[model samples]
Target chain A: MARRGDELMEFSGSISTLEELHALSLMVHEVASDWGISEKVLFEVSLIVEEFCSNSVKYGGIPVGVGIKLADSVITIMITDSGKPFDPTEVAVPDVTLPLEERKAGGLGIHFVNHFADTIVYSRENGRNILKIEKKI
Target chain B: MLINTSQKENLQIVSIEGRLDSLTAPELELWIRDNLASPEFDVVMDFSNLDYISSAGLRVMLNLSKAAARYSRKFSVCQAQDHIREVFEISGFDSFIPLCDSLDDVLAL
Candidate 1:
């Protein structure tokens, strides 16, 4: 695992590979458990991490990394990828009220991220995509 | 994830006992397609043991519900944990998929 900052704990698996999603899930579970995160908050944290990481892995065009940090009852998830400059925060929230026939498959992940995260910030700098998500525990 | 399959009153009862994410969703989808393709029987997923599910898992549920419509067979879910139910509600899955209290209850729907 690569430690990117003083506070952020980086996960071992590269965040841009589908093979790493399971490792990420398990790692998140263990880390959240250690942090005493409640089941509901843990689910939200996992959803944010898994959804963003998998999206990057699928379409990020290159390897990505994830880092997690907690402070003041708030957990922060940071995902950095050097792939394309996709900004998930800007993805349109899907209409969940649509009937089954009109429901789209892909946008739900982004919608969940939007719903679960208290705040989402996305920025591109020096050829890397940085996304920060915060959820209060 | 462990998926236990059983039969109850013409419904294929699938009880999942683990997290369903991007990695496990495809495998579950494949299993559902392979074994539950028969239109003669309805389907009900038992989620009492399932504690975690992501959008990927929700996507599979949506696909199964859509498949149920295509095949004209009833497909529903039962006994979801609170977090699981929250996911369903937020994603609008609970509205379209018949959520039951138990396997025996699925027969009533």
Candidate 2:
């Protein structure tokens, strides 16, 4: 984790185990609180971080890196994964308009990412999947 | 997370406090499996003090709601934050599971 003079706080690392997610969660909460983020935004950021990284840690078995930057009331989230090239934006979104009995479980996390984020961009560079999510505070 | 169970009138109220993420969601799920016997008592999940919930948490609640339907038990959620309610709405949980604004609202159902 690197803290600069600017409001941007950058953290990038690899975790071999799932326990690291909790540590990451604590770090996220502490940073958000230090920056005086709203409860709702912080919660959204937490969810976004968890869902993105969990897929890598639990499914892809690859190391994940996260970056959080705050500038002008806009929070930017960057996630880099060394796992098998996967694109969250391409995931088939479950029909949220469906009734309860017809609803399915898959893609809800990506659905959440889309709803909470103002914009999302996915790319692949040098065998890494980079996902950038931006949210307005 | 703090789960306090109590009886209110005839409904069994289960208040969940703190973050309900993957790390803590299973405890609540196991508690429900071990404690609540469906079809006998109506269930109310109070989220007044819950600060966070991820998809894992939502999955558990959906299981409870589905079980309620399977056994013909009344299950409702109360006191969710606006953002949380939005989550339920986005996931289509509000259609089958009632997201009440308050305990009184739940009682009225």
Candidate 3:
């Protein structure tokens, strides 16, 4: 867990465990609220968190971990999982024009994060898949 | 979220309200399992008042559609608000999940 500055909460992510996702999302909401983010921003953040965490569980391999960091006028989330080294950033965006039956669930989650986050980064290091997203308050 | 179901003729309508995120998606999953596992009937969902939907919701709906397809059952969505409709559109659910103008439309189909 990256508990350096303004730590909120830390939890372990095991296979089929969603408790950490819920707790981290709540913490993100609280930190965003504290930073005076708009209601619209909060809504968007909520959606983004749901998308990201869902992907981590549905796609990521093992042992997912989420960390929240609050700083001057910004809130950030770092999600690391030992999943099958998937870089969501690399996945092609899905064609929404396609009918639901034809369209696949490719970039829905990453697209939401990209649209909502002020900055997003994905990296694979030391056998860990790291996803960092930040939103300006 | 809790699902309450009622049937009229061959239409099995399930009305879902409240939040439908990851935490609650499982409950909906159970509801579908207990009620919709059989392939004998079509299914209609009334999400006119659902506040939130996440990827989990999408997964559940997708699985349901797959089950319906395997059993040759029809699936429809009725009375979704504009915002909810937007989600359906954004997630490309409008293609596979039939959207009826009203319950009558669903029942008629």
Candidate 4:
């Protein structure tokens, strides 16, 4: 198990793999629990991992890398993929105010990631779009 | 999660047990849309036996809540274990939807 505040742990895999996604999410859960994170905070971390990994699975072109760090009572996870640059923070929030028939069919993933994350930063660097999410313990 | 619903008067009480994760969330969405999204009925999910929920499940619930608002019907949850309830709290769902201690409380609303 990785300790909190470890500089970084990196995982590289194909975005199309379900097994890889599951492995990554489980790793997140384990690290979060080890950090003495509250269940509420744990769920938030898990949700962010699920949403971002799903996006990578659905959209990443060829390769994906997940970088993790824990420090200052906060966990920072970044997912970088070799796909079109996607800034999740710029995606519009779903209009929960809209009627069901009027609402759009997708965008729930981005919405969940945004709602659960305390801070999110997105950028395209070195031909990779990196989405970094932070959740406080 | 596997869901079973029983109706009383104008309310449809859906009971969920087991896990509600990504692959199954769509099934739940379809069930709610098919059965309770109609304008004529209100909705409350009885989560007393529900053991798990993922982000996908939360999305379905949020969509249902929005649909209920459109029809002037109420959407709420009845009963949730601490972990499941914690999921709701982190997502801010507890603020958006009414939560009761039991099915009777939901029915009395």
Candidate 5:
């Protein structure tokens, strides 16, 4: 388990399986609820975690660790994966204006992660991909 | 997730309860695909009891929408909770898919 401070609630797991994804979702929901976060903000945080964790598992093929810190009117999430050097923030945004026929779902997950998070930063260090995201409640 | 299906005229209504996340999204997609391949051409998914949705769930909906378009079938989603509807709006799914306020709205289409 990774911990930043006494106030931080952290969860870590292998991202190679769907079962872990399910567990991760449950854990995040529990922590968010325990912290008395609103349902709307919790849902957004859950969505961001799901998209990033699924992407890392399906595409990055590595283990992931997530740390969450809750503060008044602000929540910060840090996701670390030991996989390929990929930065989610650098992904291109999909064209939402395209007609249904021309639209492909390739980049929508990353797009949503970008849209919901108030601020996101990505970096690679020691062969690990670290993504930090912040949201305003 | 709990899925209940009922029929109103030619349309099949699927009411999904609980969260629709990465783990269960494939099941929903498969169910919709099976129905589309069968005699069922028109479908409406009711999300009144749905608590949450992630990108994976949204992808399943998009696939169903595209499949419906390809087969000349009718498909729409109704009764989405405010949070779920916000997800749809941010993803821009509301533009391509028919989102109804109620089951009756979809039935009327």
Candidate 6:
């Protein structure tokens, strides 16, 4: 963990496998717990990390870098991957109101991320796909 | 994650323990396909011991629910922790998958 400024505490690393995603989940949980964040926020953060990191490893076909920063009442998650230039924000949100038979499982992860995160932004920079998400605690 | 399966009357009670994310979702999918391949599709997934789940797990459950519907079989989930339940609700899974308060409730259904 590194202190970026007077109020920001940051943790960043690269993960290459699904097992590393689990480790990342544990690390984020421990850090959030140590910071005394609420369990609800912790759950959201855990799911967010899992969804993003797994998507990167499964689809990006390259090592993914994750950065988590906690400052005051907000937590920011940033994911960068060198695999492809895909922007999740451009995808359409699934129709969650559809009945079971008509529902499709694809895109729900990104939908959940969009719902849970207070704000999200995506961009391609220097051949890396970057996604930044923020949530208020 | 660990899956413990047992026969309960007409239902196959599956108790899942630990996290269900992208890494373990495939295992659950394979287990469902292999173990629950029978024509009798009445199944109850007991989530009392499950600590966490991600969208991957939700997708698996959705597929299971759809499979049961296609076969005209019963499927339900019971005893989900509050956080887990919230995940289901957030994703609108509770709308289609019958959520039971207890194993007996699912068995009775």
Native contacts retained, all candidates in order: 0.74, 0.42, 0.44, 0.12, 0.70, 0.70
Q: lDDT for each of the candidates?
A: 0.82, 0.82, 0.72, 0.72, 0.81, 0.86
In candidate 2, which residue pairs get closer than 3 Å at backbone N, Cα or C atoms, i.e. clash? none
The number of clashing residue pairs in each candidate reads: 0, 0, 1, 0, 0, 0
Residue A3, model 3, lDDT = 40
Candidate 2 lDDT, B27-97, residue by residue in tens = 89999898874646789999999888888788888788877777777899999988888899889888888
Candidate 3 deviant stretches above 4 angstroms: A1-16, A23-40, A57-76, A81-85, A100-107, A115-119, A124-128, A134-137, B70-72, B81-83, B100-105
Clashes, model 1: 0
Give the TM-score of chain B in candidate 2. Answer: 0.94
Worst 10 residues of 1 chain B by lDDT: B32-41
lDDT of 2 by residue, A1-137 (tens): 33446555554555545578767877788877887787788889989988788787776636788888777777888888777888888888788787656766678888899889999999999888899999999
Give DockQ: model 1: 0.77
- Tens digit per residue, CA lDDT, model 1, A75-109: 77888888889998778878889888888776888
Predicted candidate 3 versus true structure: per-residue lDDT over A1-137, tens digit per residue: 33435654333333346655665566666665665566566666677767776777877875676665555656676778887778777877777677545656556666666666898789999998988888876
DockQ of 2: 0.58
DockQ of each: 0.77, 0.58, 0.37, 0.23, 0.76, 0.76
Model 4 misplacement above 4 A: A1-27, A95-112, B6-11, B18-21, B31-42, B49-55, B62-74, B81-97
Which stretches in model 6 have alpha-carbon errors above 4 Å? A1-8, B39-41
Cα error, candidate 1, residue A5 (Å): 19
lDDT of 6 by residue, A15-86 (tens): 999999888888888877877688778888888878888988988957899988887678999999998788
lDDT, residue A63, model 5: 71
Residue A36 C-alpha lDDT in model 4: 69
Candidate 5 docking band: medium
Question: Which residue pairs overlap in candidate 6's backbone?
Answer: none
Instruction: Point out the worst 10-residue segment of candidate 6 chain A by lDDT.
Output: A1-10
State in Å the error of residue B68, model 4. 5.9
> Lowest lDDT 10-mer window, candidate 4 chain B?
B87-96
